[model samples]
Target: MKPVRFQFKLKYLAILALAALLLGNRGFRSLVRNYREYSRLKSEKAQLEQQRVDLEKKLAEISKKPAIEQAARTELGLIRPDETEYRFPAPKESDK
Candidate 1:
């Protein structure tokens, strides 16, 4: 009976020690932190990859002459020599 009690106590002690080591070890904490950081970085990398793909597609579109002219006219307010440009005032906002 004493040996059985000792074995049970030893098992409990081992479980407690393992729990303490897992919860208190610096390396284990760092590993958890690093895993979270790696996950966040992976998500950021995916977002950057998507952004790069979008930029590449935009670059391909703007590589064409017609797209270039459209971008210039829209972004730079440029008009062709034979075309007339018009400006309009913004509509007034009513007070609440």
Candidate 2:
């Protein structure tokens, strides 16, 4: 009876060693790190782009005189001389 033995090819071992060496290299590690940073930056850019679009829409709305007047009257408690502003108190929680 003969026992089975595993035989590894020298060329395969050399290829595996080369791969491991490359993976252990600082340059390769830095490349991986830089790629991750680039991905993060891309995500941040998307968020900033969305924010910019929202701000542009707000700016466009505020550019109109009616929108500006409405915002001012509601936000700043402003009133025109010919208009009468009414005051009301919030209803009590118990009353609800």
Candidate 3:
């Protein structure tokens, strides 16, 4: 009777240990997943910050007189005071 009681206690302890191990493993996997997401977000934040800096520099440059004039001339097709504007016709497909 004592031997049977010992065996029952041992079995219960084994099951409890296995449950604890499974819970710990799940918690560890969750920690690893969170860490990987943190690393990805950190890298993305750096990239976005660099982009913001570049855009700010571009905005500063475009706010100036020369960059604004150049943008106007090229993008908006605004000519200088003494210049004559010319528009050429599109070529046919055979021209290619």
lDDT (tens digit, per residue) of candidate 1 on 1-96: 569989999999999999999998999999999999999999999999999999999999999999999999989999999989888877768732
Using lDDT as the yardstick, the better of models 2 and 3 is 3
By TM-score, highest first, what's the ranking?
A: 2, 1, 3
RMSD of 3: 6.0
Cα-based lDDT at residue 33, candidate 3: 92
Q: Which scores greater on TM-score, model 1 or model 3? A: 1
Candidate with best TM-score: 2
Supply every candidate's count of residue pairs whose N, Cα or C atoms clash at under 3 angstroms: 0, 0, 0
**Model 2 segments more than 4 A misplaced:** 1-19, 93-96
| Poorest lDDT segment (10 consecutive residues) of candidate 1 | 87-96
> What's the lDDT of the predicted structure labeled candidate 2?
0.90
Alpha carbon RMSD to native, model 1: 3.9
lDDT of 2 by residue, 1-96 (tens): 433332346567788899898887899889999999999999999999999999999999999999999999989989999999788999999999
Candidate closest to the true structure, highest lDDT: 1
TM-score of every candidate relative to the true structure:
0.71, 0.74, 0.63
Model 1 misplacement above 4 A = 1-15, 88-96
Better of 1 and 2 by TM-score: 2
